[model samples]
Target: MPRERELILGGQRSGKSRRAEQRAADWLALDPAHRAVLIATATAHDEEMRERIARHRADRAQRVPGLVTVEEAVRLGPALARHSEPGTLVLIDCLTLWLTNLLMPAESGSASPALAETAHAGLLHALHGARGPVLLVSNEIGLGVIPMGREARAFVDALGRLNQAVAGACDRVTLMAAGLPLRLKEPG
Candidate 1:
């Protein structure tokens, strides 16, 4: 097998992020030289968010000893391209936050579509062109009822489409629930 492109999808508190981290650690174990890049896509805008981000970072550090963590909430493609080496194992915590950053209040009026498209294009380009193994984490929100507001609806729709595109390109797809992983696709 060349390098694995993995997508781990699940709902909130479904343990998807934990699975992604574990997978990255496993991938890095085979080759210690393979750097573990944690592309954290969250910015702590409030106290709760700050605490959540901190706990996650701490947990990741403990889980993957000596793993290098890079915090690039935005500018994902360029960040990955610049920081990654040939054998790097890149782990993106969640695509949902990245989408939020691109599609949030600043993009309120009619400017959202173009901005979101550009961001999505950049993300897709990165996923396809990344140098080494990549494990992307995202929420599976489409399983629930449609969101009430336009922003929420758009977010869910965009995430669903993005997940589909990534999963199609990926070599492996895993869904997590209650911290257990259900492997959907694996290399034959």
Candidate 2:
């Protein structure tokens, strides 16, 4: 059977993550050797972020026992290549954060478009060649009002483009709202 590639997008608290996890569980239950791996992109740079990460970890433990997690903040292509296999299910929770990490000025003090472009290209390439099922989660932030700040606007623009590219590559695309999934695209 051909592998499935799905893109899940939603607003805050829309349950996109939960839906992805459930799908992963279902995929793993199909075969004894099927493995589920989470590719986490968020970094705990602040107390709130740390707490959020902890909560996600706890929730995963309670919900998906067989799921393994791999933290790859920037180098996503290599990570995807390393984990994806015929009987494996790879879930990438939140791409918006990864874009933020790329666009936001780091300790070195400036954002690098060249780096972001490279990562984006790498991700698309990896997704196209994935041997197993892949699920990607990202926020639908473009639904809100336009931001007043330049950086915020830039982020929204970048995220919008990224989402579009991924959605085009995916065989299925779902939009979550109020914990309900509305299918946007499905394989014909």
Query: Per-residue CA lDDT of candidate 1, range 1-188, in tens?
Result: 23678899999999998788777778778775667888888888789998988898788889987567787766787776775567888888778888777777334443366777877778778778887878889989899888899878878888888889889888999998899999999966
Tens digit of per-residue lDDT, candidate 2, span 1-188:
24889999999999999999999889878888899999999988889989999999999989999999999888888898889889999999889888877888455568887898899999999999999999999999998899999988988999999999999999999999999999999998
TM-score of each: 0.91, 0.97
The local lDDT score (0 to 100) that residue 126 gets in candidate 1 is 78
Name the regions of candidate 2 deviating beyond 4 angstroms: none
Q: Candidate 1: misplaced stretches above 4 Å?
A: 105-111
lDDT of 1 at 31: 75
N/CA/C clash count, model 1: 0
lDDT of residue 123 for candidate 1: 76
Clashes per model (N, Cα, C within 3 A): 0, 0
Return the top candidate by TM-score: 2
